[model samples]
Target: MTGLAAASLAVSIAVAGAGVPAQAAETRRAPATATAQVFAVDWVSLGIAVAGYLFSGGGGGGGLQAAIAEIKAAIEQSKTEIIAQIDAIAAAEVEACLEAHTIEFLNIDFMDEYTLRAWAQNATSCATQASAFAGAVQSPQAVDKIGFVIGPIFAIVLAARAQAGFINGTDLVLQSQIRAYEAVVTKLTPTDCQLIVTSEGSAFYEKWWRCTAYNGDVGRSSPCFGRNCLPNRAMAETQATLNTSRPVANGALPRLRAALP
Candidate 1:
C-alpha cells in the first residue's frame, strides 16, 4: 500500500476496533476477505510502528524512559516468535524435497540467500526450495528501525485501496496467502487480540481485547463496527474486514506486500 493510504488508515483508527469512530458507517462498508487480510498484516507492521512512534519520544501516555524497556522486550520477543514458523516451513520443504528425490547431500551452502545442496555426484541449485523462502530467509530483512516503524502505515494504506476495491482480490492464490498471514499474526500476538473489522461477523472477528475510545466516544461503536467507522484507522480496518475470508493456509501466497510490487 502507498504511504498516503497508510497515513489515511493510521489517522482513522489509531484507537481500538470496537470503539472506532461513527463517521465510517456513513460511506464505507466492510471489505472483502482479501482486503481484511491486508489490515491484519498492517497491524503487525503497526505494532512495530507504535514502538517507533514511542521512539521519537512521542505517542502513548507513559514516558519513553519508563516504557522503553518493556517496548524493546516486546519487539525482541516478537521478533523471535515471528520467524519460527517461516523457518519451520522452509526446513520441512527442503527435507521433503530431498526425501522425495532420494538425494543425499554432502553439504549445504548459501548463495544470495538461496540454498545449494551439494553432493559428491550432483549439486542442487536453490533460489531456496521456494522463492517465498528466498526473500524471507536470505539475509532476512533485518527489522529496520525506520522501515519497521513506517511499514505498517504503508501497508494499511495499500490495504485501504484493496478494501475500497482499488485492488482486486479475485486471485485464489492471493487469498490463501492472506489466510496464512492472518494465522501468523494471530498466533504470534496475544491470544486475546481483537479485530475491530471482520468480513463474516464470525467469532473470528469478535472483540477480545479491551476497546479504547479513539477519535470516537469509547463505548459507543458497535462490537463489529462503530457508528462512524472513522475514516483513517477504524474506517480502513472496518472497510478491510467488511468481506474478508476465513484465513486458509496452503502457502500459496506467502510473499508480504514489500516482497511484492
Candidate 2:
C-alpha cells in the first residue's frame, strides 16, 4: 500500500480502539490515548466490535487488522489498474503517429522501398516508445507523445525527409532531360542551305512545304538531300515534347529538325 493509505488505515484502527483500557492499549503496544479522530473506513465499527472482544479476552485487534489490510489491498489494486489504462492510451498514440505520417513520408522513392520500409517501421517503434513517457505530462509539454498531426513535431520531421527525397527525384528528371538534349545536340551538324528553297510535303507536317528544309526538296518529300536543316534541333524537339506532353522519340528528331528554322 502507498504510505498515505497505510497511514490512514493506522489512524482508523487506532480510533476504533479508543475505548479500550489504557492498560490494554499499553499491553498491545499502542498509544496510551486514542486521538479524537474518526477513521474514514466505513468498516471501523466492525473493528470497534473486535476491540470489545479484545477487552473480553476473546479477540482484540484481529478484525480491524483484517479490515485495514483489505483497504490497503484495494487501494493498491486501484493504483495498478489506473496505471495500466494510462499505458494503453500512450501506446495507442504512438501507433497513430507511425501510421498517419512516418510511413507515408518514407514511401517517396520506390528505389528505397525495402530500406525505407524497414527503417520507417523501426524508427516509428523507437520514436513512439520514446514519446510514451511524455504522456505523463500535458500535451503541449510532450509534443511527440501526441498522435500524428500535420503541425506537430513529428509531421515536421516527415516533411523535411520528404522534401529531401523530392530533391533527388527532381535531379533525376533534370539529368534525363539534359542527356536527351545532349544526344540531339551531338547528332545535329551544321547543314549548308541548298541553292534553291523548294516546297516539299514532309511526312510529319500537313503543309510539308512550310516545314521543309532550306536545302533542296520540293513537295511532301521524306529524304533529305544534304546536311541542310534548321539551326536548333534539340530545342525544337524539347519544345515538341512540351507541346505533346511526352518524350520526343529519337527517330522523330530528323522530322522535327525539318520543322525547326
Candidate 3:
C-alpha cells in the first residue's frame, strides 16, 4: 500500500482504535491483522512500522484459544504504548520548530525608534530575516525539524498552502514596498519634516502619523496636514508595506499550526 494509505490505516488503528474495548472478544484479532498487513505490505516504507509480530497466536489445543487471546491483549497494549511514544516525540519536534521561529515573527524592532530612518533600516532587516525563515520552512530539510512522521502526515491531512510559500510571497511584496519607502524617506525635504513634527504633539503624532505613514493607509486623513498635504507616493508606499506586513505577521503562527497535525 502507498505511504498515505498506510498512514491512514495506521492512524485509524493507532489513534482511534488504540484503546481496545473492554468487551472486545474478536476485536483484537481484527486490529492485529490490520497491523500485520501494514508491515507485510511494506511496513518500513512509512518509517512508522513496528519491528515485528510480538505474538504468533499459535500453539497446541487444550486452552490454546484462551492463551492466544491473552497474548493478543498484551501485544495490543505494547503497540499502543509505542504509538504514544512516537506521538510525544513528534509533538516535541514540532513545538521546538515553532518556538525557534516565534520571536522572529513577532519582532517589531522597526517601530522601536521614532525616526523614519530607523524604521526604514529595521524594516529592511526584518524583511531579510522573514525571507530567510520562509525559505527554512519550505526547504527539503524541513522534514528534519517537523519530524518524518509528522511532515508527511500533515501534508496529507492539512491541505493549507505551505507556510513558506505565503511568507516568501509576502516578503517579495514587502521588499518592493520597502524600496519605495526608502526612496520617500531619503527625499523628504527639511520643510516637510518640520511641518510634520510641529503639526502635532509627539505622542499623538507618533500614534497617528506613524500608523498612516508606515502602514501606507492613505485613505485616512493625515493627522498633521490631512490627506491632501502629505506626499502622495510616500503614503502609498507605507500603506503598501503595512498592508502586506501586518497580516503576514499576524497570521504566521496560526497558519503554522493549521498546517501541522
Clash-forming residue pairs, model 2: 194-215, 199-218, 199-219, 200-218, 200-219, 200-220, 201-219, 201-220
Between 2 and 3, whose TM-score is larger? 3
Model 3 alpha-carbon drift over 4 Å, by segment = 1-195, 199-207, 211-246, 254-261
Across residues 1-261, which tens digit of lDDT does each residue of candidate 2 receive?
Answer: 122223323322333332332222111222112111111122222222222222233322444344334433322323332222223334565544444443344343453656654554444344434334333333321221121111122222322223232222222222222333233232221132223334455433211112222212222223334335433333333322221101122322232233221
For candidate 2, give the lDDT of residue 158: 24
User: Which candidate would rank higher by TM-score, 1 or 2?
Assistant: 1
Evaluate model 3: give its lDDT. 0.27
Candidate 2: list runs displaced more than 4 Å: 1-112, 115-169, 172-176, 185-193, 197-261
TM-scores of all predicted structures: 0.19, 0.16, 0.17
**Candidate maximizing lDDT:** 2
lDDT of 1 by residue, 1-261 (tens): 333222322322222243333232211222332222222333333322323332333433333222223323332333332232223342565434423222222111122222221221121212112323322432222111111112222222222222222223223222333433444223222222234554444434432123222212122123544433432333333322222221111111233333233
Expressed as tens digits, the lDDT of each residue in 1-261 for candidate 3 is: 122222322322322232333122112222233232221211111111110110111122323222223323333333333233234332354443333222222222233334433433333343343333333442322222222122122121111111111112322333332332222233221112212334354333321332232222332214444434443433333332232212122222232322222
Highest TM-score: give the candidate number. 1
